[model samples]
Target: MIEVRAPEPGDLETIGREAREEWVRDRFRTGVDFSPLMDKPNTHVALIDGQPVAAGGFIDRGNGNAIAWSVLGRVDERHFVGLVRAFRKYMKATPYRWIEAHCIATFHQSHRWVKCLGFVPVNGERCFTPDGREFRKYVFRNHNGS
Candidate 1:
């Protein structure tokens, strides 16, 4: 069974260390600890049979806007889809007027997954990370929010 709950200490680090993407592992190996973020509101960890698989949350950006983020480890298709469903419910109940997520342009799965969560790509929008990697912006507008 899959469980989605508030992240506990070390959840992010555990997920980061086991991230399926090499870039994500490299980021974690740089000594940056994301465990602290678990204390933030909306942050959550996904576990399967007691093993951490993913962690993420929305960071309120004020003015009815927020940023969505997630880090994944090795996850089976079933749990991944379950996480998507949970995220959709969270978005539906959120008070944010807009929630944005940035996807690494080369990560095709991410692009598709964001769409699965109902985020629309911003036309003509392009963003660059501090390391110079290109990214695309996607936004989810909440018609029910202010």
Candidate 2:
């Protein structure tokens, strides 16, 4: 069973340990120390059988726009779907006007996901990280509470 809950201290290491995908490793900012993100606000963790499997957070970018990011340990539909739903819930509650998500264009699954969940493409701009890998960005608007 998969459970999604608030992030705990030092859980990032567990997620890192479970992650072995090449793209997942490349998804992180190059040369940036990630230890400080363990306590980052608005972050969450997905656990299966009491072990952390994925972790991520949202960063507020002023002017009612924010960005969301996540790293996974394993690919499981139930867990991924839960995370997406939680993201939608957060968008609905927060005052942020929009939230942006970026992923490598080669990552077809993620590209499809952000699209399925209503993240619109923004001018088809491609971005590059410090490591020089190209990426695509998607934006999701915060919906009015209904």
* Index of the highest-lDDT prediction: 1
Residue 50 Cα positional deviation in candidate 2, in Å, after optimal superposition: 2.2
Can you give the TM-score per candidate against the true fold? 0.90, 0.77
| Candidate 1 wrong stretches, greater than 4 Å | 144-146
**What local distance difference test score does each model get?**
0.83, 0.71
Best-fitting candidate, scored by TM-score:
1
Model 2, residue pairs in steric clash? none
Q: Which tens-of-lDDT digit does each residue in 1-146 have in candidate 2?
A: 66767887656666765676665565352544675665656677878778888776678788888787777776576566765675566556766678898988777777876776668877758798788878899998877622
- Model 1, 2-22: lDDT tens per residue? 788888777887888897788
Query: Candidate 2 — what's its lDDT?
Result: 0.71
Which regions of candidate 2 fall more than 4 Å away from where they truly are?
A: 23-32
Residue 130 error, candidate 2, Å: 1.6
